[model samples]
Target: MPDYEPIVGRYLTIEVAGEACRIHVEEAGDGIPLVCLHTAGSDARQYRHLMCDPAITDHYRVIAFDMPWHGKSNPPVGWRDREYSLTTELYKDTIMAFCRAMELRHPVIMGCSMGGRVVLHLALEQADRFRAVIALEGADRLEPYYELDWLHRPDIHGGEVCAAIVSAQVAPQSPDEYRWETLWSYMQGGPGIFKGDLYFYWYDGHFDDRSPLIDTDKCPVYLLSGEYDSSCTPERTAATASRIAGAKATVMEGIGHFPMSENPALFRTYILPVLDEIRGAG
Candidate 1:
């Protein structure tokens, strides 16, 4: 049977984006640092399987943090003032600030959804900062952009909308038991936070027609998409990867939007190969 033991770590307060936010972080093993970033309006808990896997932890110092205002992290006063927009600038600034706070060096960054898409900016601008990046359900730009006006109405429950979206994106063959766990972040998202995040996912954070901005010469890029992800199809992700000279793309069959959380045991089947290759390269 696969190891199901839980990994433990600290809920430390770190200054990110000019605010003292308490980030929930978990880790295992020691070697190269692997920083896991969560999806939009989600937290680091999605990476529990990777953090706890003895095989992965044996070589990687896996660290996952909840974004300020997303999980257990406290939202700064500025964010509470309804300044919920997540621009590319805010995203990268927080990442750098967080990295500085953690003193991580040459770490490999891996993320999904919003976490996956925003890092394209980093790979392009500050390629030398990290060894590589793995993006899941990522694309230059996610189309079929949605309008979430109903979520903001006075009487409707927004979490249900989130649940519906997650349900629709996740493959039916995915473990039925894990579906709720995958919805936890979206269900718990702050009002307008999910919608605000989509603004960046579909627009400001977009990389469409901007291939010239990328420089894979400095850092390696790997793009992974799920077979069930309708929002960011595998074809789109592969096309995006093709635009970059050295980037690699792969499709995770029988998976969906929340690849890690959809079923980590299954997700690892594909993830390990990529990590192993990265390790071999080094």
Candidate 2:
């Protein structure tokens, strides 16, 4: 809905472990560098509204990128799952490797949903590289409703289930446009990408008790939540944040899972300031 200048985001290839993964990084604005990670199946376009905002640009530089199998990145052709879990490990390595490649030391990392999960992993694994982290609408565990007897729920699709749950959170404004874009972008990932991501969701146990790995004292952590987030409820997110020392938690009222998309104005007003505060502290 927002018109942005057609600036070409840079593409670079980084090797994670042994697999070559593609990354797209957009550098804009001024001041401290803020690296934003996109949610699962979402690309850098998720932060388009934020990137377009001069308020954020005036204070800090925004760097956003797409993951290996999302957006402009290509997926492995005819890739099938063996027993390898591709949920957290791939993203964790990719983000860390990207920072190492780009020489982004101690960046303020912020992410939403799956992106938030990735941030959590990074904070736990490489706390020194990140000054602060804000995990919005994210949890260390999968949505209980989605994992209700995962062994017997062959009829349920996590992607469809998540979409339906998030749909209920946004009211008044219709998701017709969002729905179309999501499906279009998701399907653009092709069959292999879909299979890999879904397989991770179905079989991986990455969400189980990651708090032990988190070092809240060393890295200031924050968990932000929309009041109506159906996927990760405010209570759940807050509880996860509370488990870590000095981790802050806030429940944003009158918003949904993707508050930045649903209400960009409110996000700029309520959320952007948090980034500013963290930047100042840094």
Best candidate according to TM-score: 1
Model 2 global lDDT (CA atoms, 0 to 1):
0.67
The per-model lDDT (C-alpha) reads: 0.81, 0.67
**What lDDT tens digits, residue by residue, belong to model 2 across residues 1-282?**
778663348988888878776667776777666788766555777677777787887776778888776777655343345322356667677778888887886788888877776677777777888888888777666633443233223575544544444456553342556544543444344333434453443345255477656887777788888887776688778777766767788888776767666666666667776887787785
TM for every model, in the order presented, reads 0.93, 0.81
Best by lDDT: 1
Report the C-alpha displacement of residue 282, candidate 1, in angstroms: 1.5
Candidate 1 residue lDDT tens string, 115-171: 888777778877899888889888888774567676555687777777777688788
Kindly report which residue stretches of model 1 are placed more than 4 angstroms away from their true locations once superposed.
1-6
lDDT of 1: 0.81
Clashing pairs in 2: none
**True-vs-predicted CA distance for residue 83, candidate 2, Å:** 9.7
